[model samples]
Target chain A: MDRRNNRRDAEGSSVITANRLLDGRIVWLAADGQWSPHIRNARVYSNVEIEDALKEQTASAQDNELVGVYGVQVSLSPTGPVPVTSRECIRAGGPSVHPDFTPEWQERPAVSPA
Target chain B: MSHAPHSSLPVGHYAYDEVDRTFLKQRVAQFRDQVERRISGALTEEEFKPLRLMNGLYLQLHAYMLRVAIPYGVLNSGQMRTLAQIAQRYDRDYGHFTTRQNIQFNWIKLEDTPDILALLADADMHALQTSGNCIRNVTADQFAGAAADEVIDPRIHAEILRQWSTLHPEFTFLPRKFKIAISGSPQDRVAARFHDIGLMARKDENGRAVFEVYVGGGLGRTPIVGVKLRDDLPEEDLIAYLEAILRVYNEFGRRDNIYKARIKILVQALGVQEFRNRVNAEFVAMDRARYRLDEKIVAAIQARFGVPDFDPAGQAAEKLIQQRKADRAFDFWVRTNTHAHKQPGYVSVTISCKPAGGIPGDVTSAQMNLLADLADQLSFGELRITHLQNVVLGHVRQDKLYALWQTLDQNGLGTANVGFISDIVACPGLDYCALANARSIPIAQKLSERFASPELQREIGPLRLNISGCINACGHHHAGHIGILGVDKRGEEAFQITLGGAADQDTVSIGQIIGAAMSEDETVDAIARIIDTYLARRTAGEQFIDTCRRLGTAPFKDAAYAPA
Candidate 1:
């Protein structure tokens, strides 16, 4: 199981961070659902890409290559160099943004590789 | 927990039978597949949103909300159990039953939604079109077939609309969402006039089922009672008439701005007569021969929803009545909380969600299970969710009243304040809603606390208090006897008070804002002052509205506005 070629595992998916304009301000969600400008250059990969990446793993790497892949959909502020792959976006309009509560208040789970 | 054997899922919506268990299985699988696709990114967000919405999953505030429709507010034991399971397993161990005949589970994750949908589908329920701009859950008199004043069962029409609107290809993408309500009863408790389309069941000259159609009425921004578009439309043309209206709305509605997109705005902009004519033209152009509902189809749906059989003898309930009379609490509940049923042995039971100063419409998972059991054992597997956010066991026997009341009391739903002052309707204003300017639940809670004394509320007589976070009016402030609308003034939250609005059969008046905005604390004081003035000015036996009308806003205006 080559790390990049194991299908059904979330790790092989590209790590993409999304920058969104919500009510005129840019914000994003961390792996823990916290929103801050500090954590820079986070990336995520979609399930499809992860699956494709896993399929290419050869027999030589079957046992020791990919133990488990974890995947999560995330959001972030639109600034700095964030490793963002456009494919893994879950909520296109940003992570269920609300007018009342800040992104930090939301408790989102880290994308665990399935 | 005891459970029935798994049943086969039905192939199509039309295959649903009252006794059929299999259809639930297939429907759950279908919705589950849709959910998986959405999560897997196989479907685009745009594509997935509608799919999720149809299954009652809404991405709101912090998490996904699953709104399960209780068609015509009817729910049985097994269905309730399913909801309870979803609450415990997927949601925040609680669900909120909405003013419309539906329940919303907040705090659900996107990945777990498919499993929730599967659970609901197991109970023969789904959250179809509960949100997102489409025909909403068809509401009817909660006491529909059971109410004594009902001319005919409104559920039949509701079912018809449900079928017509389910994945309706043509009207799916409307300018804005739509809501249709029907009532067979003359009491008008469902507030049909406030819906996008209100259908009142009546008989024509030939003594056949004819629908009286009303259009352009809604609660948001410009609230107007639906004007009579057609006095007596034959039963066969029901779907056609609805189609005509939808087509007219789709064609002429303003889509540039979301606020002006509702059909009500279109109707208002075009004028009622012009709107009616446009709809009429569309109706005439419609291929009557193709869309005309077949008698067989109507009969099939009607067969599943026909009134439940009940014994007319008063012998069963009479003993319970006597027993209840001995207990003061139960007696009070029986007198005010229960409603008259068409059947002598049966009665309509109101499950009040408003208790002292609690959040309206919320029910714990434990309560959901109890309600389901109660509906099964006592109410013949039938329940109704009222527009007032209370669940009604529509056909409870009088003998079961005491036991039911005790259960409801233990569950925190036994408030003898159905239509009393403390039973207020408030939206999830600034707390959760994106559109809210100020908080509504706090104002509602304050009002409820101020009028917490049951005796005081009883003395106040029938009063409706509706609060909206913003002008969007989700709480339906415009229809309340005393309405409170929240506004954001400068950088601070302010409340504007309105008076003399009523959502009843005889008259429906929009409450006019009395004066300038007041701070949250000052708002409560102002409301208390107005109530004080009404109490002082009212003639004996005159209710809040009657007093307001007699003295007018002049008297209350000065008190509410003076130095506030």
Candidate 2:
């Protein structure tokens, strides 16, 4: 799987799209719309093997998918909008934003039964 | 004449908002259903335990104790009035506000629980997470945003954590109970360091909010200070980091042995670093898609808890000084009873519940109602539950000090010994609590009676006498200057005394038990004997604690154990 996209790159380019799970091994998300996990120099794309193995998530997909990271991250901006942290924010401590999983992503059974 | 205490101050920080009303109605219906199911035996004791706990019902010595969550320790007159109604109707004419910023009614019957929950729900309150092995009522510095000396409003962070941890899926069944405390002020009046997880808000070089996280600290069989997990956690990673630690504890903490199940024992066994590594590892694996702490939500919450419109109409500090100069008692009260507030015209006034020869932290139903009324009148309807187990009215104006003092004095609450020796913290031992080995209230009463005179208490200076009936230490005996522990010697109740312990910013030391255990009468005589010895030997202005440290416990030990 293309794990490099998960790593912070100094160049900060949009490369390697879609989340790919390989042989029930590891999970990795892409940096862009590409379904693969491969990148050449600064240019990144879905790896040929990964693209061949997996299908597209959805037609209208964004840059990154949080397939691997555990908790959500909200960045702090000096002049931008600040986040809410109290119980009032959550009607009763539920998720702030519900991510819509693609049908394919939702249909996929667990690699191992949980 | 109101049975409840009265105040001349104006009420503050209150609103009967729409959201609160909706939630209250919903919770009441839910609880009413649960109570009916319980009565019908559809819900067994085991099945109903978690549900009842969430509603703050505990099966204690005589009956159930309904602990109503007082979020961040802020309450107005209306809420207090509701509490009084509950106490009068369901309980035995009283309620106890605990160190955790919650109020407990000890004599609640299971049958009346649904109605009690309904009452609390009407007041925009719930008893959720007040007890049981779950994320408890999130506690913060009671003064919070209002205290002038605060670095940041810790309540904001406290509120955030409360939302994050409430009904958290994986952590519902932990090895043992967990406690989290946060403070925005450098001078931690909340005693954050001694908690299971302590968060202190600090500023980095960039002047952004960062948290100093302390982990694996708690008080019980073993008392220990929390080790620093992160000196400066970036504001963004607060929830993620906390999730990581909790996940690790839930999965790996010991469950077979109840006593050794706390995260503290696991931390001690695995060592802090190893525990940290496991937490980080679990944190890294948590599916990020499901975890979302959004910017918009944070802003919305902050907006709701915005600073009150505070007006500095009068110079309270100057007036206080003038009053202190005119009246020596008022001067003493100002010095000992008042705490500095962040706002210019406001001060936090502590109404001592440690009445002479009475139980510490025990407020009658009438007194509670009065305090609630006083809160609505004198202060901005804002009250505080201190870790010392005393009640406080923050945001008191200087111009109203004399009038407030007069009212408090008329009530049994005006002890005027805030930081002094007589202001003690004693657990309800054999008289009320099931876990107690001996009676603690008697010892506390004896000491209170001996030092009941205000002049004598002042002469003794600031000292803490914490007494616990058993080693469970609900009374916090280890932190007292003269810690008295009641041990069962064979079948007889015996007292083991310790000296030179202090829970202050600069010092934290468990007291050393001196000599053999004494019988109940001898224990009081022994304490009286020790105090007499301190009085005879102490240098000028030397408090009981300083003298104990100087002379060591040797002299006291010799005298305490010797024949009377």
Candidate 3:
């Protein structure tokens, strides 16, 4: 697979991602097959499990819940699953223009997705 | 003749006849079916993507963006009010006016597009050919009809081009998107020399209309000023000449590399003389009778754009002159925002959307409504969206200037700086656009705040600062006196500054990049230093571009990189 556009680190861990169909909100596939808004709640797949995880998420994505489903690289950090590339980081956090508009900015005091 | 209210009023321009209404209805029905098919899994996303894009539905970072074409930047108050309604009901509470004479709703939904299009069709507007490789909305000078220097109302020809290019079968899927601009005056207000095709209207010695046709000018990753293809083509031969040009481009334009697909690249690769020779050959061989414009049709279009009955006795009221003399701010706005109108006692008012530190080109639903009301009262119910991201009331009576200015001031639309530094042209960068590499709005806001002082802006004097988030140059940064391009360097946002680029005038030149890119924090100071350098070097009464030309980029480059 051509993974050039993905945000993989030295360790090849990745997460299946898409935008929620209705509002175009960024979403990641969790282990329970439901989509989560927070990237930290994403089911991180190792290099070996990546293909299967993507396949399963693709099926879920086609169920009309998500759009533009694809895989993005992530690293299993001590804190949580962290995006590798700046593009993915922007998608995970929100637009860099306004701090108040970020997804995490409002959900800061809430329960940790990880 | 008594002025009618909004409901009873007739818009002076081309209204959709039965045939036009049927065409739009058919298009909407077709799009609705396509949307259903995509939703029901009958079509794959890959298959539906292009189909959706053809109708101007773009999936941006956070939501769907719907771009509605305001053909030739002309709209009546009813149409403007309808746009406000669409923004309030269908998408976000505000819409961004684009440099291409289009308005974009950033928070649109895929399902809601068909209904929104239906609403636009009611206003005799549509989102057709607003995206994908097609003849997009034809742009013209905002002051097309009202400008005193104009030879003819270019909107008449613009409307003609719109009718001919709307879903033209052969040219629908060109190698890349095409844009055409028309200017009626010696002053190139529409940035005519920077489009895929540019048409300038002029009259022959016998007082018959002729056009100076320019081809292959574009601003993208590769910016090029168009070369004149035909100096004097008869106005009736507009369609035939355009067909010949498009045919030549469609046949010979590169389809292999996406980056090299624009007609400008082809023109550059094959030289202007060779390209013009090929186009002339095509023009000679074409069936002239089939594409020739009829005189009756041209007359009808021209009649639609006929000047309204002016209040002959209209003059600057005593109160208005008193207000202007009393209030310095009012005097400044009058001097800057008002343009010379063709009719006596009439002036075109530029309602600036770029209030200090505000987002460029963004108008809220309330502001839109207010503008609609102002248009109805002051400008004979017509308004124009300028390429500079400001709104224009093209037919205001000079007597009512003070009243209109007061209303605009109260509504946060009256900024005294029209062609000044605070009046910035910026694109929706990383904030909303998916294609953007870095943020633009924040930088524009920062710069506007830094140059917020009217005294400072007046000192700066007629400097245009344009910011584009990427190399696409949607904001026309390459045209600004001080151009700022945002790029991603080492996974961080950085800005590259360009000096001495210009558009719209005879000395049209693409800006040259000065020094390396600077970080976001360093950009404001760097720009300030560059301006300081210009102030130090400029001769008395010299503009920013003149100063840059006199003293080369070396001094400005040094100032840009100099330690604070």
**Predicted complex 2: CAPRI docking category:** incorrect
Q: Compare the candidates by lDDT and give the number of the best one.
A: 3
Candidate 3 on B1-564: residue-level lDDT in tens?
Answer: 232333333444566677888888888899899988877878777788889888889888767889998888888888888998888776556899999879999878788888888888887788887899999999998887789999988888899999899889989999999999999898988777889999999999987779999889888899889889989999879999999889988999999999999999999999999999899899999889888887888998775553555677444656567888898988889988999998887888998998877899999988999998887777777889988999999887777888788888999998888999989999999788878777888899899999989889888889889999999989888888889998977556789998888886588888889979997769889999999988888899998889988898899999999987
Tens digits of per-residue lDDT for model 1 on B331-394? 8778778888888877888888888877777788888878877776776665677888888887
Better of 1 and 2 by TM-score: 1
Candidate 1 chain B: 10-residue stretch with minimal lDDT = B3-12
Shift in Å, residue B505, candidate 2? 4.2
Q: Which stretches of candidate 2 lie over 4 Å from their true place?
A: A1-114, B1-24, B286-297, B313-315, B535-543
Q: After superposing candidate 3, which stretches have Cα over 4 Å from the reference?
A: A1-5, A46-52, A74-86, A96-114, B1-12, B317-319
Q: What is the docking quality class of candidate 1?
A: incorrect
Order of candidates by TM-score, top first?
3, 1, 2
Clashes of each: 34, 23, 0
Q: Which candidate is the best by DockQ?
A: 3
lDDT per residue for candidate 2 within B418-534, as digits (tens), equals 877778887766555546666777777778887888788777778888888888787878778998898866435688998887765346566788878888789888888888899
Of 1 and 2, the candidate ahead on lDDT is: 1
Displacement of residue B90 (Cα, Å) in model 2 is: 1.6
Better of 1 and 2 by DockQ: 1
Clash total of candidate 3: 0
